[model samples]
Target: MKNVVITGTSRGIGLELVKLFAEEDFNILALSRNAEPVSSIELDNVSAFSFDLGTEVDLKKASDFVENEWNGKVDILIHNAGAFLNKPFQETALEEFRRIYEVNVFGLIGLTQQLMPFMDSSSHIVSISSMGGVQGSMKFAGLSAYSSSKAAIITLTELLAEEYKESGPVFNVLALGAVQTEMLAEAFPGLEAPLSAAEMASYIKNFSLTGSKFYNGKLLQVSNSTP
Candidate 1:
């Protein structure tokens, strides 16, 4: 069985992704700030733990789990946790902006660096980004902090893919448009997204399993509607 580590497994697409993987009997480590939801499921192939990307202790815990339990073999790593701030650029405080970057950018960088050792050439690192982050995509008014931070990860993914191209562990990012997720509702109240969380999760699961064979360091735009 393939060992997979997924962040943000408490809710939204992340939670759904965990369920789909568990159904397939993948050895999964599901990391979320609130572990109860996943833990309550109690699947034998799945392990749930509280993890905060900004915390060194939490990162270390995940690394230790991979090292000790999975024997340092991670077939797939999904960076799905995100921080959203829906406020005017001028109104968004410096700390709030930093918080967004902490989870969406710096935190991702930290986690990838921590787990990179456990990943080999066959491993795949898939990051979830936003369509607003894509250059020349439809820009949003109140997502300055959230969107820009997401853009950072898109570039980071490309850079890592190039750096590790010869060795392995492909890196790719998906720039999603809009999904009917809690984060989306929080960011754009009353807006109906074209896709549901489960629908997007299924797509991500399939891509994580096979996208590496055809693409690396590439950004796939997975949006049907402009947000």
Candidate 2:
């Protein structure tokens, strides 16, 4: 079975991804702030790590655990953890931006760097972005901070793909549309999403495992309609 490392597995798309991979018997290293939810899954293939992306201690512990458990041979690494804020640009405090950036950008880079040693030539690194991050998308009034972070994700993935071009470990970004999840609900209250978390998770599984072969350093936009 292939080994997969996923962050933000406590709920929503991350949780669904964990369930899908666990059912397929893939060895999964699941990182999340809360462990109880993931522990309830009762799958031997799933190992839940209580991790707060904004915390240095948690990142170090997770890195150590991964080093001991999988060595340096991760088949797939998915950076799915993210933070979202839905305040107007002016009202959004600097602290809010810092908090979101810490999780969505800094934390992501830290974990990816820590795990890079384990990734091989055949490995794939997938970063989850947002449609709002894409230029010309329907920009909402209160998504400035969140959208900017996701935009950063796309650029970072592209840079990594080029950096790793000659060696291996393909990199790609998935710019997803609104999915019916807690985060989406929180971001846009009362707005119904066309896609569900389970459906998104399935697509993510297929992409990470196989479909990523079609492209490298590309931002694939996924949504109910063209964004």
Q: What overall lDDT goes with each candidate model?
A: 0.94, 0.88
Number of clashing residue pairs in every model?
Answer: 1, 1
Residue range 1-227, candidate 1, lDDT tens digits: 99999999999999999999999999999999999999999999999988999999999999999999998899999999998888999998999999999999988989998999999999999999999999999897999999999999899999999999999899999999889999998988899999999999999999999999999999999998978
**What digit string (tens of lDDT, one per residue) describes model 2 on residues 80-176?**
9999898988999999999999999998999888788877678899999999999788888888888899999999999998999887789999999
TM-score of each: 0.99, 0.96
Worst 10 residues of 2 by lDDT: 65-74
- Among the numbered candidates, top TM-score falls to 1
TM accuracy, model 1: 0.99
Best-performing candidate as measured by lDDT: 1
Candidate 1 colliding pairs: 121-168
What TM-score quantifies how close candidate 2 is to the native fold?
0.96
